[model samples]
Target: MARDRRPPGRRGLPGLGKLFDMVDFMYLSGWQKFFERRLQRYGSTVFTTPLFTKTVVATDHKAISALFDTIPFIQDYGFGSAVPPKPLVGDVAPSVFETGVLHDNPKAFYFSLLRHRATSLPAVFEEVLREYEVRWASRGRFAWRDEIETFTMDFVLRWILELKFDTAKVRLIYNNIFTNHLWRVARFFPWTRYSRSLRYYGEFVRAIEEASSFEAIMEIARTFGISDRAYVAKQIAFLTGMNSYLGLQNLFKSIVGELSSRADIRSDLDLQLRDAAPGALFSPRVRAVDEFVMEVLRQHPPVFFIFGRAIEDVVLESASGSFDIAKGERLMGVIPFAHDDPEAFPDPASFQPERFQDDEARAKLIWPRGIQERPADTADRTCPGKDVALLLAHAFCTALVTRYQWTVVKPITWDKHRYSLNVAAPMGELEVAGFTIRDERAGRPV
Candidate 1:
C-alpha cells in the first residue's frame, strides 16, 4: 500500500483526521451525504484514508460490484469508524466473517432452517402481528418504533427458532437498550446494544443447544468453529436475535412510517388486500403492496452501510485512475449511496417502486445479484433469508395499514446523528414521538 498509487482523499477534519471523520460518519449522517458529493468530484476509484488502517472508498457501480466478490473474507470494520466496536465483529451474530478467519460460507446451510418453515411463514407472521396488534391496541399511546422493534424481534426469534419469548421480557430488553443509548454517543451505542442483546440471546443459545431438534443447527454452527458453549451462546444469539434485528427494525420503520404518512397508499393497499381475499394478504399477485415494499427496501435498505477489508491486493480501475489496493486496506460500499447513484436509479430518493415494475426498471438497477437486490431470490449472493424477510414485511404491512385504517397522531422526524442508538431509538426516542395512532374503530386523529 504505497502512498504514490493511492488516490488523494481527505484524512479527516484537519488536525482531528480520522476521529473527526468517524464522529461524522458513525454519529452524524456524514458519509451518507458525502458519498455522492465525493463521487461527483473524485470519480470512481479507491482512495486510502486514515479512516481505516488502509482504506479504499469506491462510489462507482463496477468498483462496488467487485466488493461482493470478496465477501465472507474482506471482513467488515464496522464501516471504518475511529471508535470501532471493541469486540471487532459485534454485530448480533457470529457468522463465518465474525469468526476472525473466513471459512466456507456457513450462510447457505444456516438459512436452511428458514426453508423448513417457508410455507408457514405468512401464517406465522399473521399470528405474531395479530398478537402484537392486540398489545398496541391495549396501550393508548406508546413509542411505535421502540415497540415495533420488540414485536419484530420477538416475531423473528419465534418464527426462525421456534422459541416462545415472553412479550414482557422482550419489551424489557428493548426498553433497557433504549435507556442506555440515550445517555451515550455513537461509539458507546454498540456496546449497549451488544450487552443487552447478548444478555438475552445468551439464554437463547443455551436453550437451542439443549434442544433435541436443534443438534443439526448446532452442528452447522460448529462448522464455523462456534462449538464452545460461550461462543455458541453469542453466535446463536447474534444470528437469531441481533443480526436480523437491525434489518427488521429498519424495514418495519420504513413501511409503517410511510403507511402512516401516506393515506392514499394505505387506501390503495387496503383495497388490494381486500380483493386478495382471506389468507392472501401477502400474495405476490398483489402488485401494489409488493412494489411498495420493494420501494421501501431500495430507499431505506436494511444494511445501510457496507464495509469489507482486503486480505490481499486487489486491482480496481476507475474514471480517475486504476489503483491496486494493498492487502489489509478497507473498502466501503455505502449501499444507500449506490442506490442513490443518479445514473443507476434516476430520481433515487423518490418513492417509486414502479421504477422496478418493468424492463426499464431492471436497467435502473445497479446491483444485479444480492439479497440486497430488488427481487429477493434472484442471486446466490443475495441474502439467503431475503424471501422470508420480504414475506414477513408484507405480512407486517398487511396486518397494519391494509387490514385497518389509522391516523398518525404525530409524524416521526429522523435525526441523522442518531447513529448506533438508532436501533433502540430508531427515530430518536426523545423526539420520536411514536405516531400516536387513533383507535382503529374511531379512525380519528387523537
Candidate 2:
C-alpha cells in the first residue's frame, strides 16, 4: 500500500505534526531562513501548507501585481485584528477595528485621508521638516529608533489629526508600548495577561474625546455640514493607527544602518547639505531634502512585502505560465524583487542616488509611484499611512543626514533574519557614530 498524500487546503501533515508544533512555538523566532529557502525552491510560485489554517504564500511580481490591480478580487485581511496587539503610542483608543470597520471596509477611510490635501504638499513637507530639525538639534547620541518614533508620531498627529501634544509625552507613550515585548506577545493571544491593556487604551480614548479642542474641531466640521462625526473620527483613528502600529522602528533602523555603511554616500550627502542655503536642508525642491530622502527609500524600503487576499478566483499571466488564483488565496507583492529588478533598474543593488537623478529613472522608480494620479496608498489597503509614512521618513532622514554627520560604528549588514512580514531591521543593535558636518569647504568635522 502506498502512503497517502494530503489533499489541498486540508489541515495537518501525517508525519510533520512535530515540525508544525515547533514552527508554532518559534513562530516569531526568525522565519526568514525558512521563507527564503521556500522561495528559492518554489521559484516565485504559490504554495499552500496543511496546517491548522490554510496559508498561501506567493513570491512572484507579475502575479502579485495582477493580484493588487484587481482590487475587488483581492482584499486586505485584518491580521492586526486577529493579533489584537496593543495600540502604538498615542493610539488612545481602539481604532476603526473596534468600531467595526476592520471587517466591513477597512480600506475606506484610510484611502480618503490619503486623498485630502489642505495645502500644497511641498509646503507641508517644509513645515514638517522644520519641526524635525528642531527636535533633532536637541538630541545627543540618543537611540535612533526612539527619537524617530517620537518625531514620526508628532508629525502624523499634527498633520492628520490636526492635534498637538508635548514631544516628551509622545516619546513616553511610544517607549512604554514599543519596548514591552511581553505586551506585544499578549496582543497575539487574547487571553494573555497583557490583554487588559486594551481597557487602558479605551480610557485614553475617552479622555481625548472629552478634550475641549476635540469638541471644537467637531463643531467646526458640523458647521461646514460635514455632519459625519464617525467618519472624521475613523479617519483620525486610521492616521493614528498608521503611525503607531506600522513598521516605524524598522524603518529608522534600516535608514540609519544603510547611511552608516557607505562613506562615499555620506560624503555626497554632506556636500549636498553644505551647498544648500542655511536652514534649507529640509526643502522639498530638486536640491532639497526630498531628493536625498527618496534615495534612502529606494535603498532601504520600509515595507518589503505588500499582500492581499483574493475575494474571487482570478488568473494571472506570468513569464513562467498563467496561474489560477482562487478566492481568499493570499498573494504577496514582493517589493524587494520589484525594487531590485535589473530590467527596471540598472545595477539595482548598487546604491546609486543618480539612478533617480534622471526623469526617465524617476518615471520608472516604484518608490514614488501613484503620486500624481492615484496615490500609492490609494491603490492598496495594505499601506494605510503610505503618504504620511513617506513624508515623515523624508523629514527624519533629511534632518539626520544634513544636521549630523554620522558614520556607522559597525558595518551595517542587512541580515535577512530581521525581515518580518513587512520591512527589514537589524536583529541586534545597529549602531552609528557621527560628527557634525558643519563646513564642507573647511573639510573639518564640527
Number of the top TM-score candidate:
1
Please write out the lDDT profile of model 1 over residues 1-446, one tens digit for every residue. 43436665775554577665566566554545545445555554455455534456766555666666544335444322333232322333345333323322456445655666577667777787777766766665576766777777777767666677654544444334423433335334555554555455445556656655466666666755555555554555545554566566777787877777677778777666766654455665576677787777666666654566677776665545667776776776656656666666777867786776766555434322342445433123345566667766777777676444445566655444444434212254322323333344333434
- Evaluated at residue 411, the lDDT of candidate 2 is 59
Give candidate 2 misplaced runs (Cα > 4 Å).
1-29, 50-53, 78-81, 85-140, 158-200, 210-213, 216-238, 244-252, 273-278, 281-284, 287-295, 342-347, 357-379, 382-385, 419-423, 426-446
Candidate no. 1 TM-score: 0.75
Q: Report the C-alpha lDDT of model 2 over 174-213, residue by residue, as the tens digit.
A: 3344334577566777665444445444443453455444
Candidate lDDT (C-alpha), each: 0.57, 0.50
Candidate 2: residue 165 lDDT (0-100): 50
TM-score of 2: 0.69
Show the lowest summed lDDT stretch of 10 residues, model 2: 1-10
Stretches of candidate 1 above 4 Å error? 1-6, 11-16, 26-31, 34-47, 69-93, 96-105, 166-201, 210-216, 219-233, 309-324, 359-382, 421-446
RMSD for each of the candidates: 6.0, 6.5
